[model samples]
Target: MGSIHHLIGDLPHRSLHDLSRRYGPVMLLKFGQVPFIIVSSPEAAKDIMKTHDSIFAMRPQSEIMKIITKRGQGLVFAPYDDQWRQLRKICIRELLCAKRVQSFCAIREEEAARLVKSISSDQAHLVNLSKKLADYATDAAIRIITGTRFENQE
Candidate 1:
């Protein structure tokens, strides 16, 4: 019986680190129905990621991911294959090209300015910098890609 319940209320990664300190650098954690092997040591991590990359390169697939991906139509969760390779090339050339990335610079600068102004306005108060940066990044990306900022109330 794994102590998965002990990690339920806390951030999973932080919990894993605590458990690894108590257990060992390498530990097995079972989260409800999912079992995960936690590797904390640099040597062990390198062994798994570099020496055995092919065996662990793909992410675990779930029903929700399959539905969202339309059975591997997009790049995010597509399996490593000829189709994924072609899709990656198209994405790099069309979506992430130099010209396309440069086009988003103005939107990024504007969002960054807004973020700086918001932060400067409340320097005396404790600010959630992480959340603020994440929100700014999301707004900038959406505005650049879709030509509109996401309306929170919509």
Candidate 2:
């Protein structure tokens, strides 16, 4: 209650924890567009998950997630409705099967080679590992999805 408002605005963990320490464990913080009530107690969780779970079922979709989902084109990004289930059918069966993956060991080898080459060739002592990994992953995922490379970051 002291400065819970100042501590957390977007991510409410700090403020919620502070309040729970001040008050009881089950701290209800009614703020922002969504009313976020942080329940630290196991007793409160039993009620929330067991009793009021359905009422809190199906998380509210975020705008950024929706946009990055390409309006729901990605197989993983799609909701767990009929379309997602339908799309995931082939991905589960043929695309990601153990045999299929083992057969495509060459692909993994190639990607590993790419990463190794990048690291070796870089003059900079500290490379942006995240960006480098992102480049490799994006290339691999795009190739898997479309059978085409958008751009070679190399």
Candidate with top lDDT is 1
Provide TM-scores for the models. Answer: 0.75, 0.60
Give candidate 1 regions above 4 Å deviation.
1-29, 151-154
Instruction: Put down candidate 1 lDDT per residue, 1-154, tens digits, no spaces.
Output: 4657867765877877888889888887777678788899898899888998877766778899888888867787888778888998999999999998998899999999988998999989999999889889888988987898785442
In model 2, the Cα lDDT at residue 15 comes to 65
Q: What is the C-alpha local distance difference test score of candidate 2?
A: 0.73
Report the Cα lDDT for candidate 1: 0.84
**Which 10 consecutive residues of model 1 have the lowest summed lDDT?**
1-10
Give residue 94's lDDT in candidate 2 (0 to 100).
84
True-structure RMSD, every candidate? 4.2, 5.1
lDDT of each: 0.84, 0.73
lDDT, residue 122, candidate 1:
90
Error of 1 at 118 (Å): 1.5
Q: Report the C-alpha lDDT of model 2 over 1-154, residue by residue, as the tens digit.
A: 4334656587666666666788887665555555666788898889888998756654456888888777667676666567877888978898889997787576667776888898889876889989988888887777667767667735
